[model samples]
Each structure stands twice: as C-alpha cells, then as structure tokens.
Target: MLKYMLMIVFSTFLLCGCSYSEEKISTFEGQIDYVSGKQIKVDCSNTVAANSEESGDQVGVGYICFAAINGQTKLEDNNGNSLSINDFTIEDKIKIFLESPKNIGKSLESRKFTASKVILIKASPAPK
Candidate 1:
C-alpha cells in the first residue's frame, strides 16, 4: 500500500514538471464586438473557446472584458506595440493574454492592469 502511494505521488510530480515549457506562450485570438464604459464583449474564433464568460448553460466558452479598477490601462499588441486603453475603439480584432483568476472573490476584480495584462494584437474597422 505504501509503495503504491509513493508511486502515485511521484507520478503526479513528474506530470507537473513536464507540463512546464519555457517556449509556451498563452494567447487568444478574437474580435471585440462591443465596448460600453469598461464592459467589453468579444467573439472568438469558432475553433477556440473563451476562457471566461458572463453566464451560460452551454458547452462552448466565451469571454467578456470589463474594468475592475476605475482607472486607465495600457493596451499592447503581440509585437509589443502599445496603445492607450481609452483609445481602443469598438469592433477591433485583438489578441489578449489573460491571467486566470487567482481567488474566487477576485474573479471580476482581476480584470485591471494591476491584476491582468491585456495585449491588443490587431485592430480593424468592424466589417460592414
């Protein structure tokens, strides 16, 4: 029994260690459909799923971006180009890098620059 437990523990540790890769970068490609005040609505590619969403009784994933802090933030692109969050117009295509919520109480509160980093990949006029 003891040997079996030790093997399970060792396997867990090995699985975790192997999951870490230096070259791995978290990125999401999507289109911003709406922005009101600090609230944002986006629709990602059908192939990819949203990490977070408002509410749903569905299987697929979708996300929304809202200001957690009543302050300004800097938006950047995948190439490291930066833009003022205030200047972000609606219906822009973007690549966002988000940090998963660290605490339950801080889920929505984690949307700020202090809590999360947002990178705007590409911005284009809404398709007419």
Candidate 2:
C-alpha cells in the first residue's frame, strides 16, 4: 500500500514539473519594409499565406506585419552576434518572435504586432 502511494505522488510531481515551462511565442519571418525607432514593418507577402488559400497561391494580396521592439527584446545577428535596432535596415531579412497581439486595431496599417525577440538572418545589400 505504501509503495502504491509513493508511486502516485511521484507521478503527480513529474507531471507538474513538466508543465511549468516558458510560454511559447509565435514567430514570423520576412524582409524589413520599414523601420523607425523601435518599430519595424515587415513585408511578409512572400512568406505568409492567407487562410483562404488552400493551394497557397490563389491569393495575390500582400501581407505586411508590424512589430514593436522594447528594451526587453533580444536582438541578434546571423553570426550569433548581439545587435541593436540601429543595425537593421530596409530589405534585411529577419525572424520575429512575437507576443500575442492585444487589441490589434481594425486597420492593418495601424495594427501593432508586439515582438519579444528579433533575429537578423541576412543584412541588406549596400547600395553602390
């Protein structure tokens, strides 16, 4: 009887321990369309697919997303080097880890996608 009770307690503890992990953040990848201060607009048209499209090519509409960077957000470059927003430029490819959208405004142009982290995958080419 004591052995069975111990097994039940151990199983409970294992289940509880496995459930206490960091919340998962959603990720989006695209090229930078615009950047101002801590805010960035990503042109995800080539990357994101609309829900209506089952073939993944029926829709021709562009999909752009905006993300806001705060002090807590982590920024890193392709080489795993630490970076800042200043290091980013238009046309740069980035992967954004976003916090769930809260009160996303009606207008897509005005909607804000809060980012928890931003990783730079490729830098834009320098103009000759």
Candidate 3:
C-alpha cells in the first residue's frame, strides 16, 4: 500500500512539473539560425500579441531552441496557405508552436523539441 501511494505521488509531481509558458510559448517568435534535415534552430526574441484577445496562450520559454518538422508538423504562411519544410530559408522570421513543448530546466533556458506548427512571416531586406 505504501509503495502504491508513493508511486501515485511521484507521477503527480512529474505531470505537474511540465507546464507551458503563456508568454514565451504564445509568442514564440524567432529567426532561423540553422537548419539541418528535419530540424531548425531558432534564436528566440521579442514579445508578440501580448495584449491581444487570442486564445491558447502559454507561459514562459527559452532564448534558443530546436524545432523539428515531421509528417504531423503544420507549415503555413500568414495567408493560411500550406507550405513544406523545404520552403523555409535561413534568416527567415517565423513563429513556432508546440502542442506540448518542453523546456530546458526553467524559464528562458533553451528548447530541443518537435514543432506542431510553424508560421512564416517572410524576412525583408535591410533599408539602404
């Protein structure tokens, strides 16, 4: 009986420990730093839609992370058009989303997980 209780307690703790960051995850904006095969490294920066009425906003995030694209990953443009991983280019601005993204230890740490969706917001050239 004691063993069962301990197991239940441990399981609860593990489940509760995994939480998404509303601020960071909701506004997961970054630039493509590197890409290799199915994964892309993003340099996290800035807050987006902080005061909007959008839903599904999670909290906390990292400064850098790796998001992988697979069969289930959704790639799209701002117009809601479909896209493929090949369409992505380095230095492109993007906002990534994860169904259940995991973080490294604590807030603003780092991430290395698969992406659920990726939205492209094409990069523009610098002003002359």
Candidate 4:
C-alpha cells in the first residue's frame, strides 16, 4: 500500500513540473542596424519618453541587441500596412515587442531578446 502511495505522489509532482507558462513580453524603440535572414540588430540609442521636454538627445550610451523573427511575429508600418522582414532597411526606426531576457539586470550587451512584433516609425523628410 505504501509503494502505491509513493508512486502516485511522484507522478503528481512530475506532471506539475512539466507544465509550461508563457514568458513575459517587453518593448523597446530603436533604429535598425542590420538585418539578416530571420534576425535583426537594433541600435536602441535614441529611445526617449514621448512627453519629456528634453532636447531630443539620446538618454545614454545605448547598446545594440539582436532579435530573432519567427512566422508568428507581426510586422506593420505607421500607416497600418502589413510588412515583412524583407521590407526593413538599415537606419529605419522601429518599435519592437519582445520576450524579456532572463538576465535583464546585467550589462546591456549580455542580454538577448526575441521579437514578437515590430512597428516601423516613419522617417522625417530630409532638407534639400
């Protein structure tokens, strides 16, 4: 009787341990630095608060991070047009929603983020 009880308890614990939970998502704004097959490097140097009164200077020394894109990832432009990874170009500003890295408190370059969505922010017209 004791052997059967131990087995039942062990099975219950094993099943509980195998359950999965979704990872939390985080967002960051930056410019596209590089793009490859299914990955991109972002230069998050110019991120700033929308309502701040600052002179548009970068908050601090920004670090570049790479994000992986998957089929489930959503991509869109400011005009609500759907886009693909191939539409991105270097120097294009974007806002990215991604899974926060496990070691977030560590140095900037040590973290890894996986992108879930990307929104393109239109660039301003250049002076002639």
Taken over the whole model, the C-alpha lDDT of each candidate is: 0.48, 0.72, 0.67, 0.68
Instruction: Mark the 10 consecutive residues where model 3 has the least summed lDDT.
Output: 45-54
What lDDT does model 4 reach? 0.68
Off by over 4 Å in 2: 1-25, 46-50, 53-60, 101-111
Residues 1-128 of candidate 3 have per-residue lDDT tens digits of: 99999999999999877644453353377788887668988865333233222334342233456787888988899898998877777888998887574443233344666788899988545446
Model 1 ranges with Cα > 4 A deviation = 1-27, 45-73, 101-115, 126-128
> For this target, which candidate reaches the highest TM-score against the unseen true structure?
2
| TM-scores for all predictions | 0.43, 0.65, 0.57, 0.58
> Best by lDDT, which number?
2
lDDT for model 1: 0.48
Comparing 2 with 4 on lDDT, the higher-scoring candidate is: 2
Which candidate model has the greater lDDT, 2 or 3? Answer: 2
Global Cα RMSD, each model: 7.6, 9.9, 9.4, 11.2
**Model 3 lDDT at residue 76:** 93
Model 2: per-residue Cα lDDT over 9-111, one tens digit each: 9999999867633223277678899988879898755434332223356442466778988888888987778888899999999998877634322247434
Candidate 4, which ten residues in sequence have the lowest lDDT sum?
46-55
